[model samples]
Target: MIQMLVTGPKPESVAGRRSIAVLVVILTGQFMTVLDGSIVNVAIAAIRSDLDTGGAALQLIVAGYVIAYAVLLIGGARLGDRFTQRRTFIAGLAAFTLASLACGLAWNEFSLIVFRFGQGVGAAALAPQVMTLIQRTFTGAARARALSIYAAIVSGGLLAGQILGGLIVDADLGGTGWRGVFLVNVPIGIALLMLAPRVLPVTVARTDRTVDGLGLATLTSTVLLLVVPLVLGRELGFPLWSWLCLGAGALGLAVFVLVERAVTRRGRDPLFAPRVLRAPGLLATAVTLLMVMGTFGGWLFVSALHMQSDLGYSALRAGVQFLPMGVTFAAAGLCWQRIPAVAHARMIPFGLVLSAASLGWLAWLSSAGAGIGAAASTAFALFGLGNGLAFSPLMTRALAAVPVTLAADASGLLTTSVQLGTVVGIASIGSVFFELMGTTASSAADAVAVAQLICAGTALVAAASAALAVRRMH
Candidate 1:
């Protein structure tokens, strides 16, 4: 059934009729992108088995999307600033839809991997514009509500993918099975394509904006430095080259900072605003987000694998495992409007403590076993509750200080932190888990214990950082 909301032009406020339409459209895209991230995690083994490919080919499909998505994030925002936000949004939607079709119809494993990367490129153009619209179109209290709604789409995207992947893989959908994962987006994209122009306002850029290609290239190279090692680390026996990639990634990142500072010195808009970085609270929050989301990203990937491979649960069952978290996320997002009015400066630290406690509980569960048993259920729910509160707080606080002129720049910083966190998380902790889990005669028990510990510790460190940043702001 199609869900439709009637909205119009010249609505009294940004969050009035028109903003609703844009939000709906952006949500659909956001859902598709993030869902793709996890939906494939559970199905990787199945995909490899059916396609008769090695783990590397399968991993590229996963890593390819993250890499492409991360690479394109800032550039995507830049495109929105350079061109028409509405045009960029439409073009990105069409490209992503076409790529999804390609992935669904892939005749070979290599084709599937390639198409997924293309889909990610499309997402890069689409995702940033969501924030751009919210920041541009809405204001004051309404803006916070708008931002909260959009944040849910990000989390909803993840849970939806897990559910769909599990259901499709289990259902086999007339033997289409894993292919349904990609096919699901086609209809949503088509709907958005038809409706977008009518509902989304044509917000034009103020002036001629030149893209900082050097910065973009340097940033992309720096990220791949960390991510490549993560997906390939275990398979390659954690060689010296992987270590070099890690070191080089750090160096490239440092170089990227220098390049940005230089660009800002030229009296031009850098890839990210140098001014925004000067806010001590914002910088610390960015660092905390990098660790928080990175650890969570790695945790989701490993959890899906553990559910299917180690526990011998069906894909559908694994999806069910995450249902509680999904439910809480939705509730928390919807209620986020109340946080700023009620919680004030304390919200960030509060959310962090909530998240850290959940991670600690997750550590306990992994130590016991994240199976369908009672012990796992209690701990998982606690973790989900923490996540529900944590996600929006970080996003809200990070961008709170960014002025209207710097909205896009602030958005880019936050998004980049997410990608950087994901790359490092996969490389750092994912490396640790994959390395230990696949080796030794008795690896499963050790891997779970170690991975959970890493997750717990990561969350705690992030919590401490958030607390410190919030306190400083006070």
Candidate 2:
């Protein structure tokens, strides 16, 4: 009875025609959200030039969305539990659609930043509900398959952002340039809204009615302190204030843990359930994921810069260079769960090692003065294959130990961590790249080589952590 309850609904009842439509609608919304995250990256130069903003402003445009999404993610998950996943998801999609429209029409940097933040908030509100619905709707093998496809959407969306953004800007549709990226989401969101009500499964809301406001406050504050400083610190030259903010963030994290423990002890629901923290090897998994994603984000930013700024490739041409990675990611994602647990454990380390090796090879190529060519494309494909092989296994390994009741918490935390890692990666490695460049055009190749090496280091660390985590699991 408990197992049935945890699984939510029987496979046949929810995994039918209606459910397929529901999944399509939900994944479409997801593709839009994830697309927004990366699409803006390719458009950053256009956005900056058009808006007459500085580099710092462009960074804010990117980091602002990420910060909002990360901070609100847990709250969004809790809301879905209180309000029902279907309702929460629909509401989120509506807001996201509206936010995307606002982003499209913004006239100034300030307006764009505000709208971008709104889009992030909307994304947060919708993201957790996807995983929650999958939990409630699919069972066993079907659930694994659904999750693999969802992972593909995530990776594909990142690639799409670069590819689609390049195409839209290069095409200059309606003379909108970068605006096309945000505007594209409006129609997609509208389509999802129309389809969702007709197909989504309605599940009962959980009965844990109380929200631990203090826990939420502390957690948000902690994350803000950590993330805000990382985003701005390099631009500000790592002032004393940045160090103070980092210190405060650490203190705030400690306080958040204590506050949540107190809330749980008092028999009130905590912002984060204590049990999720206690899950075996989850901490290691989170750390590994953070490092892996951090490398991924840094690689994206660095490689794009290398292609366009260093190699003088057009945006569209550079974007096309990433197609191989995207293709391999989708293909490998489908086969993610087929590997046995023992093999999966080794796959993480093996994949990361291969990923790092590819990056290192690319770095050597750049240092040797090789431009983007057949050799670089092959290296990129190998990197993509490694990424595809690693991501799903790591995600599955982390969530596998979580109780079904705590799925929402795990989902929110995991997504938040990924976004946070992205911010950190962009800030830290990007700073390294810029510092290496030293305001000289001649240094571009050297800077890119060094940045790729740094990314390889991150991948190696992730591999070490994943290997250690698996060892601990045994």
All candidates' lDDT scores? Answer: 0.75, 0.81
TM-score of each: 0.91, 0.94
Q: Give the C-alpha lDDT of model 2.
A: 0.81
Report how far residue 195 has shifted in candidate 1, in Å.
0.9
Model 1: pairs clashing at backbone N, Cα or C within 3 Å: none
- Candidate 2 TM-score, C-alpha based: 0.94
Worst-scoring 10-residue span by lDDT in model 1: 1-10
By summed lDDT, which 10 consecutive residues of candidate 2 come out lowest? Answer: 4-13
Top model number, TM-score: 2
